[model samples]
Target: MLSLTKVCAGYGGFQALFEVSVEVEAGEAVAVIGPNGAGKTTLLRVISKLIGATSGEIRMQGASLARVPAHEVVSRGIAHVPENRRLFPRLTVEENLRMGAFPRAARKRYAERLEFVYGLFPRLEER
Candidate 1:
């Protein structure tokens, strides 16, 4: 469902990823394992369009995502949860989850998605 071909990305002059390639099929789970500063997060950021790829290509079902904007990425069915978990501290759990589904496409299925989440984590519903 997703493929990266020799993708390269970085912040300014500091290179974080160099020709990294990966492919994930439908219903398949893949893990990106590396030590500190291995560009794992950078790879994700590039895939989600949080940052641009310096070289190579990222394709979602053969559609190029190189020029896609960050906000539009979720609407394309790619969800990214950064390592820091940037949640609002003052917001309730439900509020935080609602914020996650802020994209128009996700919001359309808000009720169904919220119910699914509540079912998965009963404690979240209580919170």
Candidate 2:
């Protein structure tokens, strides 16, 4: 579960999100529908710690993520895959997935993790 309470984030002096609050329960699918410049991307970025919230709090599973950095965000079970494929476009699907296990903590169990990932999404192995 993830919850954002009165989250306000912006770039420089331009505030993109104004007191935004959102809650995502486990196994629930939520969609963020909005036109361009509606802070949809900003909200995701803030939640992922790609950018820090100027004010308000973000909690995952009831634990505060105020001090969590972007790199640590993935380890916290949060990943921000934008609406683009600039990440290793030339690499094969498995290669790209392998790249995600680059962290020192993941390298030890890379093979096991890759197998788990492929098992969860069998299509990944086909690609």
Candidate 3:
């Protein structure tokens, strides 16, 4: 589970998020919906440690992530896919999927995960 408390983040002096708080329970799906420049992406970036929180705190499974680095976020069981898919257009579908499984934990179960995903969307395998 992930929790954000009174998170305030911004670029320079322009505040994008102010006292924003959110919680995501295990096995639950949450969506961030808003208009352009609504700080949705900023919220995610802060959560993923791609950006830092100016105030408040973030916790995962009750552990504080105040000083966790961006590269270590995935190892902490947090994976972030930006709004931009950022897929390698020159690569094949399988290649792209493989590219996504770069984390050590995911790499160990690459085949299994690939099969599970392909089962969910057969078109991926066909592509």
Name the top TM-score candidate. 3
- Tens-digit lDDT string for candidate 1 (1-127): 8999999899999999989889999989898899989998898889889889999989998899877888777888886776466546788988878876777878889999899989989999888
* TM-score, every prediction: 0.82, 0.76, 0.87
Candidate 3 Cα deviation (angstroms), residue 100? 2.9
Greater-TM-score candidate between 2 and 3: 3
Tell me the lDDT of model 2 at 30: 94
Please report, in order, the local distance difference test score of every candidate based on alpha carbons.
Answer: 0.87, 0.89, 0.89
What are the RMSD figures for all models against the true structure? 2.2, 2.9, 1.8
Could you tell which candidate, 1 or 3, scores higher by lDDT?
A: 3
lDDT of 3 by residue, 1-127 (tens): 8999999999999999999988899989898999999999899899989889999999999999998998898887776776477646688989978876877888999999899999999999999
Per-prediction backbone clash count? 0, 0, 0
Q: Which stretches of candidate 2 lie over 4 Å from their true place?
A: 100-125
Q: In terms of lDDT, which candidate is stronger, 1 or 2?
A: 2
